[model samples]
Target: MKLNTIAALMALAGICSVGVAAELAEDPEAIRLRIGTGDPVAGKAKSESELCQGCHGEEGVSNVVGVPNLAAQFAPYLIKQLSDFRTQSRRHRIMNAMAEGLSETDLPDIAAYFASRSRPKEDGAGGPDANAKDLFLYGDVERNLDACASCHESDARGRVSRGVAYPALAGQQSGYLRVQLLNWKAGIRNNSPQGVMNRVASQLTEAEISELANYLSGL
Candidate 1:
């Protein structure tokens, strides 16, 4: 594992021992939840001044190996991620410090800034294990496994609802997605107010996760 990944895992394990509610202390400075009010122009300024380009690359395209590509990610999902990182609900040393310093008002701008960018193309085809592809695309009817396309859409464009939030998976870093799925399964990334992802992730095996991550990365 990469150094940052190791650090994130260790931090997550530590937080897990402390209990979820206790670990996720509410931030007094966190931005209020605005349903749809992000500003791409302001977000662009924030990204430049805040040094987001250093890690996420120019326009959030992210060339860094482990870092996620933020371009074209769902705005609500981005907002929640920033909020979670800032509030200590999601544990990452670098992200935590960066988020802690941001105003709640900055969240929407950052989300909008990144969302306005075009999505990066995948480097190659996913070419995951045959069985895994079958499971992700077709699912196991006998076992009641639902196709991932059902919720994420066939192209992984994602769906949004007032109560439930689904994130786009297209062109995401496979390694990042794989680790996230594993974390969700292990109950180490459970700061979400809703439990849908935790439940869904818990149902998947390690192999299934690898396969899905590989597939989604190429979407």
Candidate 2:
């Protein structure tokens, strides 16, 4: 494992299931000093200076329907997305323009800042229905699919390992999730690690994607 990931895991050691990163978000400078990421404080300032909060909202949640919430997202995932944007591996006109201004130091710090925000509020749409739950918890074996939780963790709170972090899906915008899944299925988006999303999405029907998105958004 990378040294920074080790430190992060050590920080997580013995902590309750509530999560250690959530507590560290507010003032992560202390722990961040020893990590590959950056200071949340600086990230907050830079985010504002760059007007990130304008669309992403004050606390990393988005006001727009299709815009994804960034609150409490894993810094590693956020950093990777930004890096992808800068490299055009993940293409988005607005995101690409926005990412161009960030320095290398700014990337992780900004990611850390968003990671510091609290998780997005859950929609009161009730929990996932049977089909959605089954797909999320245990994907169809006959289809050779992996359960969503296998990578995203329970309730899609996200997962972390070694030096990688998967993004949290709970309380994310259903619209955004649906769009992304569709993009993956259509090969419009191919930036996922090891093409995992591409493969998973290819097997999903439109109805299944919608069901899955709705299921995760309320989580």
Candidate 3:
């Protein structure tokens, strides 16, 4: 069991290192493949009329637990998520209901509007616990765990290149992070890149999940 865990961590560390130094540099192919030209103006209008602001704030910062803040998220990521909810590939009772009825044309606009919004200012809460910080900066090699910074970066802002599906963790709701981590652990969520989260999270205890969530929320 220990060997298997180490092997998984070693494999993931390799996967996450692809273009680590250049992860933020835009790839033209990625742009074309992920997001076509979207009309932010139309998206704004559509979002307002659709009552999207009720849950996701007018500016895209969501106050609701388990609801993610969409502001400043990569447009294509948001588009993919909405489409996934529509197709039931990623299920959320509320999101499925909201997404299922949207027309194919409605997706791009809505994603664009949220992407155009700036993220809400962070509270500057503080730092991570020692254990959490170690996990984030340097994974437990004995357990074969890869560092979170391998993909999400030290600031927890995430990587967007090479079809990587990492999400920005900084200032994200702690409850949301905790639930998602639990989902990954339990196999309830399976949408991440190369199923990396599934493997990485399976190694974490529930207490570690909570500790990581609390640390990331303050970033």
Candidate 4:
């Protein structure tokens, strides 16, 4: 067990290093290929026309239990996710259909519109768990897991600037987080920054994943 823990930690460290390198190595051309320059105006028009309002809400907040709130999400992150859905790198029946209908030019604009909005004011759904809180704020070094806040920010708002993007977890759907974590652990999702999430999820037990997801959804 100790050896497994050590190996997991080492693996996580390597993933972090690779992720940072990938961030730094990303170039303008790469960015253009992944997500073109976003125009908020164009995005708003597309959002309305695309019927994003029906589910994501008029301002990008989702009242549905499992639908993520997109307001204030990083534009680059949003674009990347949309791209993933389009290419089937990530798979969700609803999201795949929505992404397939989106033109390449529409990706950036829609992302921009959502990114321009503020996250809707909503409290987390349940009472806090000290164990989960501790894990999210301070990962178990013994197991080689990094704190969620190390990359996600203490508030879980995520970060995006200078060609780097991290997805915001604050006020996001717990169910969605749970599903994605499971996918990462199962190797069904490999599109995370430098496969860091794959490594992170692999180190987490099923109960730990549940605790983390529940804690994050209410943030």
Candidate 5:
């Protein structure tokens, strides 16, 4: 990216109030998650009329235990998931029905509205146990497990990999995260980049899943 473009991205990051650093411009695989995103103002009105707020709170905080929070999540990721739901690729009945009625623009619009909010508050879990911390910060070499930060970042804010914006995991619902991890481990959910999630989750015991979820949700 040109210096001017990088500066402009920084300025837009401020306007969006997202936690993106201009250095991401230099990463071949990293693209700002909000680049060319939809208008949040329009999205708010759309989400309300479409009843999207019934489950995901008006502020994008999830009210249900298994549902994921969307506040300050990556817009690109939101768009991709919604697109998948529409195509039935991700396979959720309610999501598919809801997404089916949406026009093409509605996808990005809704994503923008949710992404416009700041991250949700901590889940009150405080911090991860030592085992979870170890797994996240430093993978077990004996197990050939890669550190969670290799993709999700140490802060769990996520990072762009191969132009894919890994969803932010910090402040995500523990139940939701656990279920996804379990699904990956069991090969029930198989959309992760390069099958990495499946490989990584397969290495985790159930206790480790709970431990990681508890720690990440607290962030």
Candidate 6:
């Protein structure tokens, strides 16, 4: 499906008042039982068997417009996303379908496989506005904007936090990050159950959003 179409569908899904009851019941143990925190070698075999290469690229460096580059993504993040996809906690028709068949054992192998591969150099092509840089470094507390450095770090190198999912943003394409931000604003990507990102994105103006994307891309 076209990326725009997928985005629109996700938006609709988010706004549809349908309670995601099915997704909430996802079996965490199923994934745990399968993955078992095993070695990356086993993860590689699972990735191959699951045809992850088809969309995620041969080594998880996806070239597709909407699909993210998984190469160099933290293993825990990958595992969480996989588990969410499988359980319907994260709702994406295509991803849900893809993840549905995976056993718990499959996730570790996939996570390890992508983690073991080298992260490709990002082709970031953008410049940041001075105001955007200021916002990133020192948030406008009066406006209730939090500093990006608090979670993503001053360098934007992701750091893990307990009970929170912090994804690496450094070296990621700016356009991709912008798209994701827009998705969060539009409620298309509901990764945060507590709606932190939704609230944050809602407060940002179009220009600020553009500037932030540009700034992160150049980082």
Q: Is candidate 5 or candidate 6 better by lDDT?
A: 5
lDDT of 2 by residue, 39-151 (tens): 66667778899888998986788988778899778888888999999999999999999998889989887777677666786566427488988999999999999999899
**TM-score for all predictions?**
0.77, 0.84, 0.77, 0.77, 0.83, 0.74
Clash pairs, model 5 backbone: none
Q: How well is each residue in 1-219 modelled by candidate 4, as lDDT tens digits?
A: 132332243244342134323432444233232223576556777898998878998778887777878876777899889999999998889999999999988988888667656554456463478998888889999998999888887887676656668778877777878888898999998998789999999999999888888788787
Sorting all predicted structures by TM-score, with the top scorer first, yields: 2, 5, 3, 4, 1, 6
Q: What is the lDDT of residue 216 in candidate 6?
A: 73
- 4 or 5: which has the higher TM-score? 5
Which candidate model has the greater TM-score, 2 or 5?
2
Off by over 4 Å in 3: 1-36, 121-126
Residue 188 lDDT, candidate 4, scale 0-100: 91
CA lDDT scores, all candidates in order: 0.69, 0.78, 0.71, 0.73, 0.77, 0.64
Off by over 4 Å in 4: 1-37, 124-127
Q: Pairs clashing in candidate 2?
A: none
lDDT of 5 by residue, 1-219 (tens): 243453354355453343333333444233335433576667778989999998998878888878889886887889888888888878787999999999998988788777756677564663748888889889889999999987788888776567787888889888888899999899988777778999999999998999898888988
Ranking by lDDT: 2, 5, 4, 3, 1, 6
Shift of residue 156 alpha carbon in model 1, Å = 0.6
| Candidate 6 lDDT trough over 10 residues, lowest sum | 15-24
Superposed model 2: Cα runs more than 4 Å off: 1-36
Worst 10 residues of 1 by lDDT: 26-35
* lDDT (tens digit, per residue) of candidate 3 on 92-156: 89889999888887888787666545444346543649999899889999999999999887878
Q: Residue 25 lDDT in model 6?
A: 31
TM-score, candidate 3, is: 0.77
Highest lDDT: give the candidate number.
Answer: 2
Candidate 6 structure, TM-score to reference: 0.74
